[model samples]
Target: MLNAAETRCDALIVLADVDHVIHVPLPNFTFQRSIDLQGILKSFLRKALVERTGQIERWDRGTWESFLSPLWKCVVEPVMDALAFSTPGDLSRIFWCPTGPFVFLPIHAAGLYDTKYSAPGHKVFDFVVSSYVPTLSILAPSRNIYVAHNDDFRLLAVRQPPTDGRRLSRLPGVHTELKHIKEVITNSGSACATFLEPSVGTVEEVLGLMNEADWVHFACHGIQDAKNPIDSGLCLANERRLKISDIIGLSRSRGGLAFLSACQTATGDEGLSDEAIHIAAGMLFAGYAGVIGTMWSISDTLAPIVARDMYEHLFRNGTRPDYREAAWALHEAIGRVRESGEVSFNEWVPFIHVGL
Candidate 1:
């Protein structure tokens, strides 16, 4: 949306290459060059998300490579060529705007990983830092908010670990994550932060605190109601949920960033694919300049590590941290996650940045 002088990154609105994506996990899925797109896409989601996802956690390297190679060949390679990127370069950034069913896919992590003797990776991560934008219009108002401001860069970190009787798993890493955050913020001498852990991270309490802070981080359970996207939200204390409707209500001028370290925060409804209905987009519409969201569920073990590194990178300036740096911070943090031996594709690929 920026004029030529203000443009800093390449924007690629992705139209899903069905041949590569739809056929990756569904080898036996019948296809024609010209097929009913709606029916096929819904079927693909049912199989991959519902059927095969049961085994996604245990996917071997062979399976990971098979899917990635096709994804690179069909989707990412063309974009890279058009941008004149033959190999990895420094300081390159791309803002991906994936259209249709592609929103659920991870475009940032696409590369030819396996298939034959391909060992040294040629992944998209090497060439550029990647971020996402729901739409171009969402960017115009965020320019000023993303920059440094006169007021203190206040931060709110919320952690709602799974308690007894809840179906969710416990997040043991969030404790260490809060410790890391405190250490980072204390050393930065700029960010004024508050923590609401355990029994306090309720819907009303979080919204109340969000009013006082410009930037916010959530290390909690995120529920994605595919049938009703409006109900999709972060799981908070006492079984209270902070739905998308609740978030967009806090629209303000001073907002900077919202780091949603929760599952399916950016995964939109397949039926209404073009609409900006997810938590990340809700945060943007709520007036935050940027947001860090996940396309699918994330491992509790890795989320805190990513969050800690992201904040460290953002606040490296030691004064008021620039919200514009959130994308690069997330990019660098996920790079570490990828290199953190024994990580599968699903584990590292879900963490994504949306907005400036």
Candidate 2:
């Protein structure tokens, strides 16, 4: 049998959270933890393995089956069966980080701040995005070619409904405080280019506008299909959902930075996969350099403010200060607003990094 590295492959499979992932959503979500892992392997693992192993090794169905059987029974098969009952469009919301020749990035969702084996196994070559999201570089230094497809609400608003104690701790002064931060970045000229959609627009418009610069930023909303993760999309003001297909088309034609400042742009819906892999994964899969995404719901008014500040810091300072540094910069900036008494300190810390 050919060795893992020796076998030239067409793709790869990366398993995130080999250690453990919470698998549970915050609340008011439908995706189940047990199904999330199973769905990941079935939707992503099986095919990637076949693609890579197909060319050289004669797959031992029995051996492979035995190896995966435990995961299948304990993980894959169950999720696949559960998802099978889902409607045609429903499966689209399910997502997984494929492993094998293709790169697999599995972030320990709960342990992001902790030092662990979370980075990918290969040398990353690009960056991808759906909207103008902050903290991509901090997640991984390897990506270079970022891509942005539409808008992400998490990038725009700092808070959403059903806010709780955990949400409040992450972002205290999300509205006015965040806006103040954006003021510094926009006027500083730190951004190479910015794209602001006026109500309604098309993928073509985004593609054309994206062509103008190395970094792409969109302050908009993103819709997530909790059941079918892939079906998740950007919520355009025109009341349309920008699907991943639109993003793939755009990435095929150009390359640069893509930021999604919309809700769930990077973060997968509950019961779906963790690490915002579904959305950002599409950008990476479509051949972008890197993608940055958000973890949970955000404060609408405050999102732009934090996003603007984050970009300015990264663009001017460069993305080398470490993850916490980026988080701190944004955190501190928001803190200043609170100190100034423009807003209370209870409204900061909602937005979090969703991807690399």
Candidate 3:
């Protein structure tokens, strides 16, 4: 960690340097149950992703708040206390690096959301703007780079529909999503050039655009290849794919932010969870300062709304999009969705912010 200087507004500007704290909570306490923390972690993901996922999406309040309540009690809250983050907003910015099966856990979403007796400031997001890294070593390089003051914030936004002969589910909301994003960036006096299906949505075009742009976004169907991590990629037009290998080749000096609205963009291979080889992390390796991804699948209908709110906050009719505000903008957007009470727990928890 390094000392960060404050801006004229007194807000801490995020640095390219990695200033972080890591806490492995298992050794800090003795468990009354026979099960070890490792076993508990294994069960938690299995239950959430495979066993009782339907209950989490459709059950009553008990099931709705199940993972969050216990996670706060056992993992996140204890870490907060050890760090002496005892009040709301004690830390303005924080990032999580969950290893092994814990990568599947929503540490940012930890806290009792439905319990009547829970304190107002019990949630992790209540304390700081949360981001994530698979490991400290991943962010200890040339990331968190920002566009220069003289440069215009050029964004390359893409929306991929189902290509011919592929049975991929369509995201009908992406039309409105790209429209909203374009409107926001245009008002900010920036470029939000978009490419949709049946146009220049090919891999070659996208990669070229990404190289020339400061910001990039993808709203499409994502494919994760557990057998071979490099094969994992997002769907593009003309049956072409943007594989993880492709993203790894990108090292842009002007890289800023990448918003991945596709499913499972943050999910790593189950067999190699400790490595954290996933699309979102790939974007970080490609030199983007901040990345937005989902731990699992998200609602097709709600994707546009989430995108709209986040870009609105990031731009705010300003002259440019502050790539530094990516994490805070994400936190604010997810908070609005969660507090709306119109979405299921599944709909809101999958959204995650990664990197600085």
What does candidate 3 score on TM?
A: 0.83
| lDDT (Cα, 0-100) at 241 in candidate 3 | 82
The C-alpha TM-scores of every prediction are 0.82, 0.43, 0.83
Cα error, candidate 3, residue 199 (Å) = 3.7
Error of 1 at 165 (Å): 3.0
Each prediction's RMSD over C-alphas, in Å, is: 7.6, 17.2, 7.1
The list of candidate 2 runs beyond 4 A from truth reads 1-186, 189-194, 252-256, 269-277, 317-350, 354-356
Q: Put down candidate 1 lDDT per residue, 36-59, tens digits, no spaces.
A: 333433343344432111133445
Per-residue CA lDDT of model 3 for 1-356, tens digit only, reads 11111211111123345375342334322332112433554454445532111233333456547646766776667666665677885656776676555666677877877667456588888777878887776555455445456766678888875455346655667788888898887777755565544466667778888998888889887888889987898888765789999998985774588999987898888787768899998888887778999877777777888899999998885767777788888888888887788887777878989887
- Candidate with top TM-score is 3
For residue 211, what is the lDDT in candidate 1? 88
lDDT of 2 at 24: 17
After superposing candidate 3, which stretches have Cα over 4 Å from the reference? 1-60, 89-91, 138-142, 163-166
Query: What lDDT is obtained when candidate 3 is compared to the true structure?
Result: 0.71
Ranking by TM-score: 3, 1, 2
